[model samples]
Target: MFRNIVVGLSGGVDSAVAALLLKRKGFNVTAVFLRNWDTADETGKCLADEDYKDAEYISKKINIPLVEVNFVKEYWHEVFTYLLESYEGGYTPNPDIMCNKNIKFKKFYNFARENLKADAIATGHYARSSFGPYLEDYKPGAKVKLLHAVNQKKDQTFFLSQVSQESLQRCMFPLGEMMKTDVKKLAVEAGLGVIAQKPESMGICFIGTRTFQNFIPQYLENKPGNFINYETGEVVGQHQGIHCWTLGQGCRIAGSSEKLFVLRKDIKTNDIFVVPGTDHPALFSRILITSKPHWICEEPESLIDSWTVLNCEYRFQRNEKLCPCRVYKSSNNKLIIVSEKEKRAISPGQFVVLYLNDECLGSAPITHAGPSLHSLGEGEITSDVDDNDGLLRASTV
Candidate 1:
């Protein structure tokens, strides 16, 4: 029932379904396909050419105009460079987060509104938006509140947290209310062609099934380094380079009987350390130093430094345990997490997201990690406890 809208048609079922939903609701809709990467060459051999074709077909079937915007140069200048820098700095940065905040929503939104004259832009992301009776009712100056999808398992609010408040107001997520199964079923019911049964892309958002290392040689000058075990302080193996691996990665530790996961990487020593086992509870950490916290609400008028209870998820584990945490600042102006529980594997460069109950509060980029403790909350502690803690055990040095 709204006016003009633009849906980011990615040639995926979710996007196709989203566009269909808008049309069914009787809203004026157009499909905008962003050409982020070039796949016509050998470099794009692994790319999904079929998906693009399907997207074009779906737009035709829906009777909506489709627009193609080439963002390959932008992707290289903005996203690819950022990704390389994060990795070179020995951090596991989430490219999807930056991609959404910088390109898809920021640049794309501007083009769609200023050039296309669209009232709003939409995507098939698995996150929800709550629009009030009127725009002013949502927030005083803000337009929308992005929330986790009803399907918690598929919720992508984590990737969307970096988006600005203004961008969120003008955004729509049509498939946010629908479950994944329902989304696919709708695609089938709509008579979408070969794409209806296409297997979902599971690798990196942009480069599917391609070894990132293969692409890294283009940007990073990899230098092979010594791999060691922290406990023994002995050279266990040699790595292709510290730049080639990330924190908590367990594969390819030299000369180890126990399966080792990467605990830390030392830039000065050019060394990488590994710990045994993937389920080592020590790999998880309750306390982590976070930086660059962004609030979706209005910027706080004054500097209010206080501790508040917030929901936290380190990764996409289904049963993400809750830990009480207090957020404070360090002498050098970084957010430090002092926790009530001994969590594990706090990785530098990974996103430490905060939540208020089910709603997203904001997030911070983890810059540093603190030492692991033996005891937490009045329990008989042992070295095994440390092993189970997952923080020190999985901590990448």
Candidate 2:
């Protein structure tokens, strides 16, 4: 058990409850409010100030010491820059994943250990962590194992997959085994009514309520492009920018009775290819290639040399059921995942977290998606495109 713990309080009921629980458990508890974003929202109001006020109020109510630290520069450089660049390069990057890896767990954990002199850092993240065998030693209880939270609906293991194992060993998730409903009830019973009823934050932490289209243009130049029909090769509509759209996004194709979805984006031509209907064949892919993966503990022995078949969830949040898949390595050392069933919207830049039952094995960033071998009727898959595109335009053989 940890003797001293610092909880990253974000002016939310979850963090407040975590701090209270840590205090009740007799661990030295201190609440730290992280100021990772200093920009004002669309309404010209600084959201961080409001969050700090709530955090201060909660700390006073809970009778715990509160500290505020700024990580704005770190976040802007490490997380925001990558996010904008990924979109500019026609990929949908997950900033939350990067934020956890670079800021919350890495930067905040270091500060707590060095400055606060804390034994471990805690957060309201709904993911469980336990000790396991080290990756290199294979000695039992030598490493940390990241697992899914008990509250499956609120489980955040996917976003947390990128956290380093060393940081995870010193990290505590107080809400791991508690449901969101129970946390709210506990907060109210503990005389924290204001925070108990507060609504959960949505969208990116810094962007707040502003739309991505409005916020992105402020950072990168928008290049308008034609919206082409994938099947007929006809330009049916036009878009303000290809970066504004992502794979499987519903397009309001002017004059079309049926709803159209983005099937692919040709970066060289600056054209977005669309197909009619949400369940278009082009939207589903059976093959996905990923960049070098990072394992939480160790890569399973079954996946080391030969192709190993495993059950995985392509997008865990939307689709809960596991999809059977086989994992292999390419000559270039990238991972190749072949799903038995077609997966919808296997977008580049999103993460594909692998799991064995409840334990999170590791994760990789999706770099390419193509139609399954069975899905192709005649011609073989072609790679006749620039590598900068970051996605393969799936076509039938």
Candidate 3:
């Protein structure tokens, strides 16, 4: 029921169907082609030509104006730079979360509101939004409440945890209530051109399918190191570089029949220790310590005597569940989960989101463990508490 809306058009079926849905709702929708990268490899066709053409065709079919916003510089400076630094510093990074935070929501949101004069910005993200009944003690004019998307498999709320409450108020996600299959069916039914069968892009940030190592060499000089066994400090393998491998990787140890997983990294000694078991018990823990907490709910007035219960998700696609937590800022502000039944692979640089039932309470950066992927710069080891605990965490290199 809103007019003057700006929808991000990715030249894919999801955004294409989103534009159609907004049009059906009688909104003055304008599609914008966000130029996220500049891959100029001539042989690889590493450019945005096809995507631009698709956007043009879709815009024409939808009878809406199409705009282009170039964000290549921001992607490089903010997201890619951090990714490179995190690797060199010996920690895994999530560029996708950074992309959502700095690019899609922050920069893109500003452009739509200020330059395009849009009343609201919409995307094809699989998350829902609604206005909640205001509480007597609640702050006035708090109209935004984020909810999980209908298609549970495709839910993306984890990446969106960083979105400010102010931005969430003006943001809209039309595909949240609908399943991916339904969106595809609508695209075909609406007679959208070639994009009706376009495949979803699962490529890494800017560089696409190329290994992070390939791209890292362009920005960093490699430092080779020794790969040692956990029990004995005997050298069993040698790595091209310590930064090339990520924590939790089950890489084959050369010259040994025993498969080894990275357990610890000693940057000072340039040693990468490998453990023996794929299901090593020492790998999992049940306690988590997080820092830099971002609360979407009412900010707790100091951590004093605050014993509150909340639900948390360590990764997207995780079901929300109850966990007893307390915020303690007496020394380095952090959220401590005291009563989680399961140990999780709380990766050092990933996010830890808190929820109340389905509504997001807040989120924090995972700083320490209760079962997590432990990385000591040169190596990593994953641990899970009993097999039945519901804390959601995913392993990524």
Question: Candidate 2, TM-score vs. the true structure?
Answer: 0.90
Candidate 3: residue 360 Cα off by (Å) = 2.5
lDDT of 2: 0.80
Q: lDDT per residue, candidate 1, 50-82, as tens digits?
A: 557877899998889998887888987788788
Query: Candidates ranked by lDDT, best first?
Result: 2, 1, 3
- What is the lDDT, from 0 to 100, of the residue 309 in candidate 1? 26
TM-score for each model: 0.85, 0.90, 0.83
Candidate with top TM-score is: 2
Model 2, span 1-397: residue lDDT tens: 4678899999999999999988988888999999988888889899999999999999999899999999999999999999988998889898999999999999999999999998788898888876421112123457778988898888888889888987888877888888999999999999999999888987687888878878888888888899988778988988888788888889887887778888888777889988887776667766778888889988777667643444454453323656666666544557777666677778888888887778888888988776632255422333432121322232111
How many steric clashes between backbone atoms does each model show?
27, 2, 12
Better candidate by lDDT, 1 or 3: 1
Candidate 1 C-alpha error for residue 321, in Å: 5.9
Give the residue spans of candidate 1 off by over 4 A.
39-48, 132-143, 279-282, 299-303, 306-324, 329-333, 339-341, 374-397
C-alpha lDDT (0 to 100) for residue 54 of candidate 3:
90
Q: List the residue pairs that clash in candidate 2.
A: 378-397, 379-397
